[model samples]
Target: MLRITAGKLANALRGTVSGTSRVAAVRCLHGTEESAEEFDKRYEKYFSREGIDGWEIRKGMNDLLGMDLVPSPKIIEAGLRAARRVNDIALAIRWLEGCKDKCGDHQATLYPFLLEKISPTLKELGVPTIEELGYDKPELALKSVYDL
Candidate 1:
Protein backbone atom coordinates (compact mmCIF):
# COMPACT_ATOMS: atom_id res chain seq x y z
CA MET A 1 0.00 0.00 0.00
CA LEU A 2 1.22 3.53 -0.77
CA ARG A 3 0.20 6.73 0.97
CA ILE A 4 1.15 10.15 -0.34
CA THR A 5 0.87 13.29 1.85
CA ALA A 6 -1.45 15.97 0.44
CA GLY A 7 1.47 18.43 0.24
CA LYS A 8 3.50 16.03 -1.98
CA LEU A 9 0.39 15.27 -4.08
CA ALA A 10 -0.41 18.98 -4.55
CA ASN A 11 3.23 19.73 -5.50
CA ALA A 12 3.03 16.97 -8.13
CA LEU A 13 -0.30 18.19 -9.57
CA ARG A 14 0.13 21.97 -9.04
CA GLY A 15 1.16 22.70 -12.65
CA THR A 16 -1.98 21.18 -14.22
CA VAL A 17 -4.29 22.38 -11.45
CA SER A 18 -3.04 25.98 -11.65
CA GLY A 19 -3.34 26.06 -15.42
CA THR A 20 -6.96 24.81 -15.34
CA SER A 21 -8.00 27.09 -12.49
CA ARG A 22 -6.89 30.23 -14.36
CA VAL A 23 -9.32 29.66 -17.24
CA ALA A 24 -12.08 28.58 -14.86
CA ALA A 25 -11.44 31.64 -12.72
CA VAL A 26 -11.74 33.99 -15.70
CA ARG A 27 -15.05 32.37 -16.69
CA CYS A 28 -16.31 32.63 -13.12
CA LEU A 29 -15.48 36.34 -12.93
CA HIS A 30 -17.78 37.14 -15.85
CA GLY A 31 -20.52 37.91 -13.35
CA THR A 32 -19.81 41.11 -11.49
CA GLU A 33 -20.80 41.64 -7.87
CA GLU A 34 -23.87 43.82 -7.40
CA SER A 35 -23.99 46.57 -4.83
CA ALA A 36 -26.08 46.04 -1.72
CA GLU A 37 -28.63 48.61 -2.86
CA GLU A 38 -28.92 46.91 -6.23
CA PHE A 39 -29.35 43.56 -4.52
CA ASP A 40 -32.13 44.97 -2.35
CA LYS A 41 -33.84 46.55 -5.34
CA ARG A 42 -33.59 43.40 -7.43
CA TYR A 43 -35.24 41.25 -4.79
CA GLU A 44 -37.78 43.88 -3.91
CA LYS A 45 -38.78 44.09 -7.53
CA TYR A 46 -39.00 40.29 -7.78
CA PHE A 47 -41.40 40.03 -4.87
CA SER A 48 -43.43 43.06 -5.94
CA ARG A 49 -44.10 41.76 -9.40
CA GLU A 50 -47.70 41.19 -10.52
CA GLY A 51 -49.20 37.67 -10.42
CA ILE A 52 -46.49 36.27 -8.15
CA ASP A 53 -47.81 33.08 -6.58
CA GLY A 54 -47.10 31.46 -3.23
CA TRP A 55 -44.72 28.90 -4.72
CA GLU A 56 -42.77 31.64 -6.44
CA ILE A 57 -42.66 33.67 -3.26
CA ARG A 58 -41.30 30.71 -1.30
CA LYS A 59 -38.73 29.97 -3.98
CA GLY A 60 -37.57 33.55 -4.05
CA MET A 61 -37.32 33.67 -0.29
CA ASN A 62 -35.36 30.41 -0.26
CA ASP A 63 -32.91 31.82 -2.80
CA LEU A 64 -32.51 35.17 -1.03
CA LEU A 65 -32.09 33.66 2.42
CA GLY A 66 -29.73 31.00 1.11
CA MET A 67 -27.26 33.70 0.01
CA ASP A 68 -24.02 34.37 1.89
CA LEU A 69 -25.33 37.73 3.13
CA VAL A 70 -28.56 38.56 4.92
CA PRO A 71 -31.08 40.56 2.96
CA SER A 72 -31.80 44.22 3.56
CA PRO A 73 -34.87 45.40 5.48
CA LYS A 74 -36.52 46.76 2.35
CA ILE A 75 -36.21 43.42 0.59
CA ILE A 76 -37.76 41.65 3.56
CA GLU A 77 -40.57 44.19 3.70
CA ALA A 78 -41.32 43.62 0.06
CA GLY A 79 -41.27 39.82 0.51
CA LEU A 80 -43.65 39.95 3.48
CA ARG A 81 -45.97 42.17 1.50
CA ALA A 82 -45.94 39.67 -1.36
CA ALA A 83 -46.65 36.81 1.02
CA ARG A 84 -49.61 38.74 2.40
CA ARG A 85 -50.86 39.43 -1.11
CA VAL A 86 -50.68 35.68 -1.75
CA ASN A 87 -52.60 35.07 1.52
CA ASP A 88 -49.83 33.03 3.13
CA ILE A 89 -49.46 34.22 6.71
CA ALA A 90 -47.25 31.27 7.64
CA LEU A 91 -44.77 32.07 4.89
CA ALA A 92 -44.57 35.65 6.03
CA ILE A 93 -43.79 34.59 9.58
CA ARG A 94 -41.25 32.00 8.49
CA TRP A 95 -39.42 34.52 6.31
CA LEU A 96 -39.18 36.81 9.31
CA GLU A 97 -37.54 33.97 11.23
CA GLY A 98 -35.27 33.26 8.30
CA CYS A 99 -34.08 36.88 8.23
CA LYS A 100 -33.44 36.76 11.94
CA ASP A 101 -31.33 33.62 11.59
CA LYS A 102 -29.40 35.17 8.72
CA CYS A 103 -28.42 37.99 11.04
CA GLY A 104 -25.69 35.60 12.25
CA ASP A 105 -23.65 37.09 15.13
CA HIS A 106 -25.09 40.54 14.35
CA GLN A 107 -28.54 39.56 15.56
CA ALA A 108 -28.35 41.92 18.51
CA THR A 109 -28.22 44.86 16.14
CA LEU A 110 -29.35 43.69 12.73
CA TYR A 111 -32.45 41.68 13.71
CA PRO A 112 -33.85 44.46 15.86
CA PHE A 113 -33.15 46.97 13.11
CA LEU A 114 -35.05 44.77 10.69
CA LEU A 115 -38.01 44.47 13.06
CA GLU A 116 -38.14 48.18 13.65
CA LYS A 117 -38.00 49.06 9.96
CA ILE A 118 -40.48 46.37 9.00
CA SER A 119 -42.84 46.76 11.96
CA PRO A 120 -45.23 49.16 10.26
CA THR A 121 -45.62 46.77 7.35
CA LEU A 122 -46.02 43.89 9.78
CA LYS A 123 -48.83 45.68 11.57
CA GLU A 124 -50.48 46.64 8.31
CA LEU A 125 -50.25 43.06 7.02
CA GLY A 126 -51.32 41.48 10.35
CA VAL A 127 -48.25 39.29 10.64
CA PRO A 128 -46.88 38.49 14.08
CA THR A 129 -43.29 37.47 14.57
CA ILE A 130 -42.42 33.94 15.66
CA GLU A 131 -41.28 35.23 19.03
CA GLU A 132 -44.37 37.36 19.46
CA LEU A 133 -46.45 34.26 18.76
CA GLY A 134 -44.22 32.28 21.18
CA TYR A 135 -43.20 29.54 18.74
CA ASP A 136 -39.38 29.84 18.76
CA LYS A 137 -39.14 26.74 20.92
CA PRO A 138 -40.22 23.32 19.69
CA GLU A 139 -43.71 22.39 20.84
CA LEU A 140 -42.74 18.72 21.36
CA ALA A 141 -39.29 19.14 22.89
CA LEU A 142 -39.64 16.54 25.62
CA LYS A 143 -36.94 15.03 27.83
CA SER A 144 -35.12 12.11 26.27
CA VAL A 145 -36.02 8.65 27.58
CA TYR A 146 -32.35 7.94 28.32
CA ASP A 147 -32.21 11.03 30.55
CA LEU A 148 -34.50 9.32 33.02
Candidate 2:
Protein backbone atom coordinates (compact mmCIF):
# COMPACT_ATOMS: atom_id res chain seq x y z
CA MET A 1 0.00 0.00 0.00
CA LEU A 2 1.33 3.47 -0.95
CA ARG A 3 0.47 6.36 1.36
CA ILE A 4 1.49 9.93 0.45
CA THR A 5 0.26 12.83 2.55
CA ALA A 6 -0.68 16.14 0.88
CA GLY A 7 2.14 17.94 2.75
CA LYS A 8 4.73 15.45 1.50
CA LEU A 9 3.52 15.78 -2.11
CA ALA A 10 3.50 19.58 -1.90
CA ASN A 11 7.05 19.61 -0.49
CA ALA A 12 8.24 17.24 -3.26
CA LEU A 13 6.70 19.42 -5.97
CA ARG A 14 8.12 22.58 -4.42
CA GLY A 15 11.62 21.05 -4.48
CA THR A 16 11.25 20.29 -8.23
CA VAL A 17 10.54 23.92 -9.18
CA SER A 18 13.05 26.75 -8.76
CA GLY A 19 11.77 30.01 -7.22
CA THR A 20 14.61 32.02 -8.73
CA SER A 21 12.59 33.24 -11.74
CA ARG A 22 12.06 37.00 -11.61
CA VAL A 23 8.45 38.09 -11.37
CA ALA A 24 7.84 41.55 -12.79
CA ALA A 25 6.46 44.08 -10.39
CA VAL A 26 3.02 45.39 -11.22
CA ARG A 27 2.51 49.16 -10.95
CA CYS A 28 -1.03 50.52 -10.79
CA LEU A 29 -1.58 54.23 -11.58
CA HIS A 30 -4.49 56.25 -10.29
CA GLY A 31 -5.73 59.85 -10.68
CA THR A 32 -3.28 62.01 -12.66
CA GLU A 33 -0.31 59.79 -12.19
CA GLU A 34 -0.91 58.28 -15.62
CA SER A 35 -0.03 60.60 -18.49
CA ALA A 36 -1.93 61.26 -21.71
CA GLU A 37 0.98 59.93 -23.77
CA GLU A 38 0.92 56.67 -21.84
CA PHE A 39 -2.85 56.39 -22.34
CA ASP A 40 -2.51 57.10 -26.08
CA LYS A 41 0.14 54.40 -26.42
CA ARG A 42 -2.07 51.88 -24.68
CA TYR A 43 -5.14 52.71 -26.84
CA GLU A 44 -3.14 52.70 -30.07
CA LYS A 45 -1.41 49.49 -29.18
CA TYR A 46 -4.69 47.71 -28.47
CA PHE A 47 -7.35 49.21 -30.76
CA SER A 48 -5.70 51.11 -33.61
CA ARG A 49 -5.69 48.15 -35.98
CA GLU A 50 -7.82 48.10 -39.11
CA GLY A 51 -11.13 46.19 -39.00
CA ILE A 52 -11.45 46.54 -35.23
CA ASP A 53 -15.12 47.02 -34.52
CA GLY A 54 -17.40 47.95 -31.62
CA TRP A 55 -17.23 44.49 -30.15
CA GLU A 56 -13.46 44.74 -29.89
CA ILE A 57 -13.68 48.29 -28.56
CA ARG A 58 -16.25 47.32 -25.95
CA LYS A 59 -14.19 44.30 -24.93
CA GLY A 60 -11.02 46.37 -24.64
CA MET A 61 -12.76 49.12 -22.66
CA ASN A 62 -14.36 46.51 -20.43
CA ASP A 63 -10.95 45.09 -19.58
CA LEU A 64 -9.48 48.54 -18.97
CA LEU A 65 -12.41 49.65 -16.82
CA GLY A 66 -12.38 46.35 -14.93
CA MET A 67 -8.98 47.14 -13.54
CA ASP A 68 -8.72 49.14 -10.30
CA LEU A 69 -7.55 52.09 -12.33
CA VAL A 70 -8.95 55.51 -13.14
CA PRO A 71 -8.34 56.90 -16.59
CA SER A 72 -7.94 60.55 -17.46
CA PRO A 73 -10.54 62.55 -19.41
CA LYS A 74 -8.48 62.36 -22.59
CA ILE A 75 -8.30 58.61 -22.35
CA ILE A 76 -12.01 58.35 -21.68
CA GLU A 77 -12.69 60.70 -24.60
CA ALA A 78 -10.54 58.56 -26.85
CA GLY A 79 -12.45 55.49 -25.81
CA LEU A 80 -15.76 57.23 -26.52
CA ARG A 81 -14.52 58.28 -29.94
CA ALA A 82 -13.54 54.72 -30.67
CA ALA A 83 -16.99 53.54 -29.65
CA ARG A 84 -18.59 56.20 -31.83
CA ARG A 85 -16.50 55.11 -34.81
CA VAL A 86 -18.10 51.70 -34.52
CA ASN A 87 -21.59 53.09 -33.74
CA ASP A 88 -21.51 51.72 -30.21
CA ILE A 89 -22.41 54.90 -28.36
CA ALA A 90 -24.79 53.04 -26.07
CA LEU A 91 -22.04 50.74 -24.93
CA ALA A 92 -19.75 53.72 -24.42
CA ILE A 93 -22.40 55.47 -22.34
CA ARG A 94 -22.85 52.35 -20.26
CA TRP A 95 -19.12 52.20 -19.75
CA LEU A 96 -19.15 55.81 -18.57
CA GLU A 97 -22.02 55.02 -16.22
CA GLY A 98 -20.07 52.19 -14.73
CA CYS A 99 -17.08 54.44 -14.34
CA LYS A 100 -19.24 57.14 -12.70
CA ASP A 101 -20.60 54.60 -10.28
CA LYS A 102 -17.15 53.35 -9.39
CA CYS A 103 -15.11 56.57 -9.54
CA GLY A 104 -17.64 59.14 -8.32
CA ASP A 105 -16.85 62.81 -9.03
CA HIS A 106 -14.01 62.31 -11.46
CA GLN A 107 -16.07 60.18 -13.81
CA ALA A 108 -19.20 62.17 -13.09
CA THR A 109 -17.49 65.28 -14.38
CA LEU A 110 -16.37 63.44 -17.51
CA TYR A 111 -19.79 62.04 -18.33
CA PRO A 112 -21.24 65.42 -19.25
CA PHE A 113 -18.12 66.49 -21.07
CA LEU A 114 -18.25 63.40 -23.21
CA LEU A 115 -21.99 63.77 -23.73
CA GLU A 116 -21.48 67.26 -25.10
CA LYS A 117 -18.78 66.01 -27.44
CA ILE A 118 -21.03 63.27 -28.81
CA SER A 119 -24.41 65.02 -28.70
CA PRO A 120 -24.32 66.09 -32.33
CA THR A 121 -23.44 62.59 -33.43
CA LEU A 122 -26.12 61.16 -31.18
CA LYS A 123 -28.67 63.55 -32.70
CA GLU A 124 -27.64 62.43 -36.16
CA LEU A 125 -28.35 58.86 -35.09
CA GLY A 126 -31.89 59.87 -33.98
CA VAL A 127 -31.11 59.37 -30.33
CA PRO A 128 -32.56 62.06 -28.06
CA THR A 129 -30.26 64.97 -27.55
CA ILE A 130 -29.30 66.00 -24.02
CA GLU A 131 -30.98 69.40 -24.33
CA GLU A 132 -34.13 67.87 -25.78
CA LEU A 133 -34.22 65.53 -22.83
CA GLY A 134 -34.20 68.71 -20.62
CA TYR A 135 -31.63 67.21 -18.32
CA ASP A 136 -28.65 69.23 -17.23
CA LYS A 137 -27.13 66.45 -15.17
CA PRO A 138 -25.13 63.81 -16.98
CA GLU A 139 -26.69 60.96 -15.03
CA LEU A 140 -30.18 61.95 -16.12
CA ALA A 141 -29.03 62.55 -19.66
CA LEU A 142 -27.55 59.09 -19.72
CA LYS A 143 -30.78 57.61 -18.43
CA SER A 144 -32.68 59.32 -21.23
CA VAL A 145 -30.27 57.90 -23.79
CA TYR A 146 -30.73 54.44 -22.34
CA ASP A 147 -34.49 54.81 -22.58
CA LEU A 148 -34.08 55.55 -26.28
**Candidate maximizing lDDT:** 1
Per-residue alpha-carbon lDDT of model 1 for 1-148, expressed as tens digits?
A: 1356877777887756765565444334538655667667888999999999999999999987766668888999999999999999999999999999999999989888889998999999999988789888788899889998
CA-only RMSD, every prediction = 7.6, 10.2
Cα lDDT for residue 70, candidate 1: 82
Task: For residue 44, give model 2's deviation from the true position in Å.
Answer: 4.3
Which runs in model 1 stand beyond 4 Å of their true positions?
1-30, 140-148
Q: How many residue pairs clash in each candidate?
A: 0, 0
TM-score of each: 0.72, 0.48
Residue 39 lDDT, candidate 2, scale 0-100:
57
For residue 143, model 2's alpha carbon misses the true position, in angstroms, by 18
- Which one wins on TM-score? 1
